[model samples]
Target: MPAFDPCYTLIVLAGGQGSRMGGCDKGMLTLGQQTFAELLVHRLRCSAAAFNPGYGPVLISANRNQQDYGRIGAQVCADLRPDFQGPLAGLEAALSRASPDLPAVIVPCDMPLLPDNLPAGLLRSVMADQRSVAVLHDGHRRQHLCLALWPQSALFSIRQRLDENQRSVAGWLAGQLVADVTFSEESVGALPFACNINRTSDLAQLPG
Candidate 1:
């Protein structure tokens, strides 16, 4: 793979308890027509194809309803460890489920209006910076928790962090060789991406 190539296995992270949403399946929540995870998968697949049109599989890191997520036309896996330990657990599952050599792009299932250039921009930083992970820096904030790309080389450090009870994704990231790819309205097509629907009422926060 070339250093700047835009090819990667995509991981749609939906393995949360959705405690704020009253234990609902956030990924299965319908926004307009399709569910959140479904919409994200569709948009990402379309955008990636338009960007490079290459071969890369999509993986879903879902804790429950494995069958439901499987229907999305992608491989699905649960957290390697127990509980919804956050995106890091989901990410570990994603890494294990994907081809060993290919790096994977991780995106939360709730961000329906994600940037089209997310994978490319992050992957570019991954290669250029030679870092274990490269994540989105949304101009004013580093969106480090859920959106990013990681290579298999990161598995050891990740496993170590999780084993030591270091569950915070941002906290674990601070200890690794990471890159922050900046994004602005002019660059990413949206400012700060989209607000995650933490509650059912949050649907109103979506664009009209």
Candidate 2:
């Protein structure tokens, strides 16, 4: 609903070690017709068009299968610190590799059911008063650090956090001026923008 700059890079977070998912790259897991990373990019592209038809290309943050992720036709980047630093590090890597000309939208590859209007809505909040960050809050909780839109200004601050080893995504976000947009608890029978497949059982349950 909020107007925003159409040009922005989408950063798909897939660099985690996936400790809960048996130490495998969750993004490589298949659901429906393709891998999670591939499917995420597809859905994001479709969703982004509703907000900005000129939305910049997508980038995937992964520690493994860079070539495979790259095969998805997205710029593939890895975490700055190779010790599995978590999603914040993935976000940091994305910023480091992204062009400074546009803001970056960050989403997790595990979340295949992200809402269509999310990127646009978050962009509107950040672009409105020129805030550095904007995040989402489902009726139950704040998705916080991951599902958000950030301006070019966040690069340095994020770099600083990484420099000082501040790897807590929530902590870093707590220190910044962030705006929150709430969404309905669910859409139909599913959690809109919140269906993250984190376990083997989850992957097995994906809708056909």
Q: lDDT (0-100) at residue 72 of candidate 1?
A: 84
In model 2, the worst 10-residue window by lDDT is: 184-193
* Clash tally for model 1: 0
lDDT of each: 0.75, 0.75
Error of 2 at 166 (Å): 1.7
lDDT of 2 by residue, 48-139 (tens): 54565455778898999999998888888888787888888888888888777666778888887776567776776766655558887777
True-vs-predicted CA distance for residue 75, candidate 1, Å? 0.6
Question: Each candidate's TM vs. the true structure?
Answer: 0.86, 0.87
Candidate 1: C-alpha lDDT: 0.75
Can you tell me which runs of candidate 2 are displaced by over 4 Å? 1-5, 46-55, 187-192
State which candidate has the highest TM-score.
Answer: 2
